[model samples]
Target: MIGVDTNVLVRYLAQDDEAQSPVASKIIDGFTPDAPGFISQVALVETVWVLTRSYKMTRDAVADTIETLLRARELVVEGAESGYLALASYRATKADFSDALIAHGGRLAGCRETVTFDKGAASAAGMRLLGAD
Candidate 1:
């Protein structure tokens, strides 16, 4: 079972990047009854974030993306509750809670380190901020 990453779903939904769309399409299409695709909870949450923020998709569009993924039956998720709650709180906090949840969830999941882009989150407690790129 191949693990689907957030970028794959984002590219499939966005369809704006010509170079990667065919690859994304093929990957998604492979999730047939015989050959199913798989995705993690983190990918699901990140996909929503990318769809809304990066692609400028509306809430309805984001919902449609999620619906399509759910219908695929190929996607598998872990920590569904954590992902949902993290996304919800992140959205509610206007992105402020994203890193916090990521850090907290990572710790709960027994990760050694939680990497993030938010400086505030890095300073909070257990998160490590990535260098500016």
Candidate 2:
């Protein structure tokens, strides 16, 4: 499987860069289950950040995008089950997808609870509040 970078995914999803979009689409569309494209956990998180922060996509839009990526049969998403859990958290709460992904990763690794100072993460990302009273 070939590893896909965040830029490639951003180009395919955003289609904002005319020069790169076609190439990205070609690569993505050419993948098959026999030789699926690999998307890393890091690339997935960065793609979410780019779509939301730089492209100004809404939270629901970002969640939908993530769902599309996760569901693509030609794409092998690393940490996908945890990624799905993160997507669910992103859709159902105010927690950042990145934070939810981090917490989910911790949970999959057998963490009892992830501790954090961010109230949004604690309340919405399934993490424990480190200091909030």
CA lDDT for candidate 1:
0.67
**Per-residue lDDT for 56-132 in model 2, tens only?**
99998999999999999999999999999999989999999999999999999999989999988888898998875
Any idea how many clashes model 2 has? 0
Query: For each candidate, what is the lDDT?
Result: 0.67, 0.94
- Which digits, one per residue and each the tens of the lDDT, describe model 1 over residues 1-133? 6777888877787787889988998988777665677877668768877777878877666655665665556655565545555545454444433464576578678899988776777775447889987
Candidate 2 Cα deviation (angstroms), residue 11: 0.6
Cα displacement (Å) at residue 91, model 1: 12
Q: How displaced is residue 14 in candidate 1, in Å?
A: 1.2
In lDDT terms, which candidate is top? 2
TM, every model: 0.57, 0.95
